[model samples]
Every structure is written in C-alpha cells, then in structure tokens.
Target: MFGYSEEQIAAFGLSFGVGAFILYMLFIIGQLAWESKAGKFGTFVMFLGLAFGMVGYLAKYIIRWYLER
Candidate 1:
C-alpha cells in the first residue's frame, strides 16, 4: 500500500509490466546458456544481452524484498 488511488495503482501496473519483462529475459538466459554450451556462439551473445537487461529488474525485486521486512 503506497497510498495511491486506484488509477495511480493501475499506472504502477504498467511499470510492473516492464519489470516482469526483465524477469522473463533473465529466465531466457538458461536457454541461451544451453545454446552456447552447444557451440552456438551467436546465440550465447544474444542471451547474455537479454540477461543483462534483466539485471535492473532483479535489482528492483531485491529492493522490494528488503522493504517488506
């Protein structure tokens, strides 16, 4: 409860959508890692970029977790 109105809360949802995308990218790292191990260097680079993008989202999650305590 950040004390925002319903509309404001909905607006927050938009940001959360972005955060979710980051998490999804992180999850995709597994697939990329596998491809890399299989000798697909190009796919590995692509996956690494995606996982890096997710780092910001992962940081957000960490912050949220700490705040909840």
Candidate 2:
C-alpha cells in the first residue's frame, strides 16, 4: 500500500508508531499527576511506578542494538 512493502510499513509502525504512543502515555501520566495535585515526590513516584515497563521495553531495543554491534 502506498508503494511501500509490508515489511517497510510494519517497521515504520513498530518504530515511530509505538514511540509516539509511549510519549502519549507519558503525557497521560503527567496529566494524571497534575489533575490529582500530586506533589513533586508523588509525581516522581507515580512516573517511576507507571513508566517502569516502558523502561524495560526501551532497554530491550537498546540491548538488541548493542548485541548486533
């Protein structure tokens, strides 16, 4: 579709699309903290708790790149 192969489209979606979604999720977390009037430490804890999974996901990509090199 649109002159791009399936593999190319899938790669683009996996990379940019998921990345954008992750950022959006972070925004949502921040908004949650703001709306709830979480203090600085509370906000930090919230992010540490909520965004921890994202850290592992990003780390997997980094580890893969390192292993490939």
Candidate 3:
C-alpha cells in the first residue's frame, strides 16, 4: 500500500508510532502527578514507579542493537 512494502510500514509504525505513544504516556504520568499536587519527591517517586516499565522496554531495544553489532 502507498508504494511501501508491509515490512517498511510495520517498521515505521514500530519506530515512530510507538515512540509517539511512549511520549504521550510520559505526558499522562506528568499530568497525574500535577493534578495530585505531588511535590518534587512525590513526582520523582511516581515517575520512578510508573515509568519503570517504559525504561525496561527501551532498554530491550538498546540491548538488541548492542548485541547485533
């Protein structure tokens, strides 16, 4: 479709699409902390707790790149 192969489209979606979603998730986490009036330490803790999974997911990509080198 649109002159692009399925693998190309899928790669684009996995890279840019999921990247955008991850950014949006960060925004949501920040909004949550803001609405709850979480102070600096509280906000830090909230991010550390909530965004941990995202960190791991990103790390997986890094690890794969490193191993493939």
Candidate 4:
C-alpha cells in the first residue's frame, strides 16, 4: 500500500505533468519531420508509451480505490 498524503498526490500530478510534457515535446513533436522506417517505428513506440503513461497516471487513483475497498 502506498501511504501518500495530499501533498504527495500533488507531487505525483506535478511529476506526471512534467514527464508528459517532456514526452510530447521530445517524441511526439519529433514525428513532425519523420519519414523513414526507424523514425516511423520510433514514433509509434513513443506514442504507445505516451498513451500508457497518461492512462496509468490517470487510473492510478481509481484503480487503487477499487482494490482498496
């Protein structure tokens, strides 16, 4: 069990925000000029990683609530 207070929850949000921003800026934005096999594959993987990160972050609390109860 993760024993986190309100401040910790806010920190999670902050960290997630920063990470998501970095992912979008570095990977997502790079796709704008991608036209090769490696670039395309890299872009695809980056998108999946980004999606998973967002989904996991948003679902953490909901999943924890369900499992805890």
Best-performing candidate as measured by lDDT: 2
What is the clash count for each candidate, in the order shown?
0, 0, 0, 0
User: Which whole-number lDDT from 0 to 100 does residue 55 have in model 1?
Assistant: 67
- With a 3 Å backbone cut-off (N, CA, C), the pairs that clash in candidate 1 are none
TM for every model, in the order presented, reads 0.43, 0.90, 0.87, 0.37
Using TM-score as the measure, name the better of candidate 1 and candidate 2: 2
lDDT of 3: 0.93
lDDT string for model 4 (1-69, tens) is: 288898988888777876778577656545653744447677777666646666675587678789999
Worst 10 residues of 4 by lDDT: 29-38
| Cα displacement (Å) at residue 39, model 4 | 13
Question: How high is the CA lDDT of each candidate model?
Answer: 0.71, 0.96, 0.93, 0.67
Q: List all candidate RMSDs to the true structure.
A: 5.5, 1.0, 1.1, 7.2
Question: Candidate 2 lDDT, tens digit per residue, 27-65?
Answer: 999999999999999999999999999998899889999
Residue 54 Cα positional deviation in candidate 3, in Å, after optimal superposition: 0.5
* Model 4 quality (TM-score): 0.37
Candidate 3 structure quality by residue, lDDT tens digits, 1-69:
999999999989987898899899999999999999999999999999998988877888899999999
